[model samples]
Target: MKVAVIGCGLIGKRRSQTAMEHPLSELAIVVDINPAAAEAVAAQYGCESATDWKAAIAHPDIDIVAVATHNGLLAEIAIAALQAGKHVLIEKPMGRNLAEALKMAEAAKAANRILKIGFNHRYHPALAKAYDLFQAGAIGEIINIRARYGHGGRPGYENEWRGNPELAGGGELTDQGVHIADLIHWFAGLPTEAFAYLQTAIWPIQPLEDNGFGLFRFGDGAIASFHTSWTQWKNLFSFEIYGQKGSLTIEGLGKSYGIERLTIAYRKPEGGVPDLEDLVFDLPDTSWELEWQDFIEAIAAKTPYWGAPEEGVSAMRMLDALYRSAKAGAPIHV
Candidate 1:
C-alpha cells in the first residue's frame, strides 16, 4: 500500500523507517511544515516530499496516511484522511479531550475506513505474554496492578511537541499517562472510576505537569496504581500484577526499542521445579516492526484494529477525571 506519513519529526521518521521495511508498504510521500525536513526524509526514503499535508492527502497513490503530527491535531487530520478514502494510523493521545476523539470516531464510522490509534504497549512481547498468562489462568484473578513509566528527561525531548500542551496535550499524564490508563483498561477491563494527582515538579518551561499519579478502580476488589513521570534520573518502565494463583511481572517494556523480559511466578501445585521461575521471552526481533506489520495486515483484512477510537475516548475520560482530582484534591468518578 502507498502511504503518506505526515510529520517529519522523530516519531514520523521512525514510523516511516519501519514502514519502509514492509514489503507491502511504499513510502508515497512525507509532509512537514518545514520544507527542508520534508525534503530530507523524502530523499532518504526515495519518496515525494511536500510542506503541506493536503497535497500528499490528495495524491491518488497515497492509500494510507499515518499521522504523527501534533497530538491536538490528530482528530482533525484523521477525519480528513477517513473522508478522503484513506486508512489512518495515528500516534497516541488520539485527542486532547474526549469530545474531539468522539467526533473523529464518528467521522471514521461515516467514512467506513480503518482508523487505528497507535498504542504500541500492547505489542511488547513481555506485556503480550503477561496478558496471555492472565487470560490462560496462569494467574487466577487479577486483584491489583502496579505500573510505572518514566524516563530521565530523555534527550531530544527537552524541547519538542511532548513538552507543549498545545501540541502534545496535557502534561506527562496526558502524554504518558494516557498510555498506562489505556493499558490498565486493556488488561484489567474497563475502569469504574479514577482519581489522580499531577504535579509540575520538573521541566520548568512546560505548563503541563511532568509527573502524574492515579488510582483506578476497576470492578470490585480490583484497583490499579499507576504513575507517569519525566523526572526520573534513570529511565524505568515496569509492571507487576497480583492474582490469586500467580504473580506476573513484565519489566523493561518501555522506551522506543523496549527490551521485553517477562517473569512469571506461580505457586507450586505441590512439588514443582523450584519454587518459582522467570521465563524469558524469545519471540519477535523488534516490537515496532511487529506493530506496523499488524496495522498493515488489519488494513488488508478490513477487520477491527487494536486501538479503537472508543478506547481513545475512554482513556481521555479517565484522564479527565484524574486532572479533576488533581485540581479538586478529591477523587472524581468517571
Candidate 2:
C-alpha cells in the first residue's frame, strides 16, 4: 500500500515511520503547508514531498492517506481524500464540530472508502489488555468508568495553534477529552445524556477552556465521569472501570507518565479481602503502528474499520452535547 501523510508534525512523522516500517506499506509522500517541514520528513523517509495537500491527495500512486492536520482541517482533508477514492486515517476529534464530522462520515459512505479516526489510546498495551479482560467477564458487567488525562503546558503554550479556537475547535476537552470520551463510548456504548463544566482558569488562551469535567450516563445505567486538563503539574493518564463483580484500573502511559500498568481486583463474595492482579508493560509504544496496521488490514480485507467514521461521529455528538450542556448548565440528551 502506498501512503501519503498530510501534515508533517509529530503525529505525521509517527504515521510515516509506521508506513515505512510496515511490510505491506510504503511512505509515498509527505505533505505539509510548510515546504521545509514536508521536505525534511520526506527526505528522512526517502519519499516525495509536496506543499499542497491537494496534490498529495490527488496523486494516483497514493492508495491511503493519513490526515494528521489540526482538528479544523481534518474533515475537509479526509472528505477530499475519501472522495478521491483513497482510504483515510484521520486524527482525533475528527473535525472542529459535529457538522463537519457528519459531513466526513457522509463522504466516506458515499465514496465507499475506509475511513478511520486515530484513537491510538485504544491500542495501548495496558488498555488493550483491560479491554480483553472486560470482554472476558473478568470484571463482569461494567457499572461505571472514571478517567482523567492531562498534561502541563510549557512556556508560551498560549501562542501555539492549539490555543487558537479557529484551529483547535476547543481547549483541553476537544484535545485530550475526545480520547477519553471515545474510550467511554467504546466500552459502554454512546451515552444517553451528558453534563459538563468547562473552565479557562490557568491558560490565557481566549474563549477556550483549559479544563473540562463531564459526566455521561449510558443507556444501561452505566455512568462515566471524565476530566481532561491542561493544568496538571505532572502528566497523568488514569482510567478505572467498575463492574458488578470487580474493577479494573489502568494507570500511567509509559515515559513521563510512568510505567504503564493495569490492575484488576475482584470483589470477595464472602465479604473478605478481594483478589488483585497487576499487569505491567515496559515496552516501547506501538499504538501508532498497531492502529495503522488495523486500518491497512481493514482495507485489504474489505472489513469494517474499528475506528470508523461512524465512531467519529458518535464521539463528536457526545462532545457537542457536552459543550452544549456546559453552556446551558444542564444535562443534555444525546
Candidate 3:
C-alpha cells in the first residue's frame, strides 16, 4: 500500500511514521500548506513532499490517504480522496459538523472505499484491555460511565488555529469531547438524549468553549457523564465504567498524564469490600500504529472498518445534539 499523509503536524507525523513502519505499506508522499513542514516529514521517511493536497489526492501511486488536517478540512480532503478511489484515515472529530461528516460518508459509500476515523483512544493499551474485559462479561452489564480528559494549553494557545471557530468549529468539546463520546458509544452504544454546558472560562476565545460538560442517556438505561476541558492545570485522562458485576476504571495516558493503568473491581456477594486488580502499562504508545494496522486489515478483508464513516457520523450526531442542547439550555433528543 502506498500512503500519502496530509498536514505534516504532530498527528500527521505520527501517521507517516506508522505508514513507514508497516510492512505492507510505504510512505509515498507528505503534504502540508507549509512546504518546509511537509519536506521535513517526507525527508524523515525518505518520501516526496507536496504543498498541494489536491495534487497528492490525484496522484495515481497513492493508495491510502491519511487526512490529519484540522476538523474543518477533514471532510473535504477525505471525500476527495475517497472519490479518487483511495481509502482514507481521517482524524477526529471527523468533520466540522454532522452535515459535512454525512457528505464524507456518502462519498465513501459512493466510491466503494474504506473510510476510517482516527479514534485512536480505542487502541490505547489500557482502554483496549478494559474493552476486552467488558466484552468477556468481566464487568457484566454496564450501568454508567464517567470520563474526563483535559490538558492545559501552552502559552499563547488562544492565538492558535484551534481557537478559531472557522477552522475548529467548536472548542474543547469538539476537540477532546469527541474522543470520550466515541468511547462511550463503543462501550454503551448510542445515547438517546444529550445535555451539555459550554463555557469559555479561561481562554479569551469567544464563541468557542474552553470547557464542556455533557450528560448522555442511552436507550439501555446506561448513562455517561463527561467533561472536556482546556482549563485543567495538569494533563489528565480518566474513564470509569460501572457494571452489574463489577467496575473498570482506566486512568492516565502515559507521559504527562502519568503511567497508564487499568483497575478492575468486583463486588462481593455478601456486600462487603470488593476484590480489586490493578494492571499497569509503562510502554510507549503504539495506538497510532495499531489503528493503522486495523484500517489496513479492514481493507484487505473487505470488511466494515472498526471506526468507519458511520461511526464518525454517530459521534458527530451526539456532538451536534449536545451543542444544540447547550444553546437551548435544555436536553435534546439524539
Mind giving the per-residue lDDT tens digits that candidate 2 earns over 1-334?
Answer: 9999999998999999999999999999999999999999998989999999998899898999999988878989999999999999999988999999899999989998999999999999999999999999988988999999999876676788799899999889999998998988888889999999999888899698999999999888999999999999899999999999999999999998889999999999897778999999988998988998899889999766568888888999999999999999999999
Clashes of 2: 0
* Whole-model Cα lDDT of every candidate shown, in order: 0.82, 0.92, 0.93
lDDT per residue for candidate 3 within 49-73, as digits (tens), equals: 9999999999998999999987779
Q: Give the TM-score of each candidate.
A: 0.92, 0.98, 0.98
Q: Name the regions of candidate 1 deviating beyond 4 angstroms.
A: 154-159, 254-259, 268-274, 281-285
Clashes per model (N, Cα, C within 3 A): 0, 0, 0
lDDT string for model 1 (104-216, tens) is 88988898888888888888878877888888998788889998988757555648777777777787898878889888888787777788887778576356888999998
Off by over 4 Å in 3: none
Off by over 4 Å in 2: none
Question: Would you list the rank order by lDDT, best first?
Answer: 3, 2, 1
**Superposing all C-alpha atoms, what RMSD in Å does each candidate have to the true structure?**
2.5, 0.9, 0.9
Q: What's the alpha carbon RMSD for model 2? A: 0.9
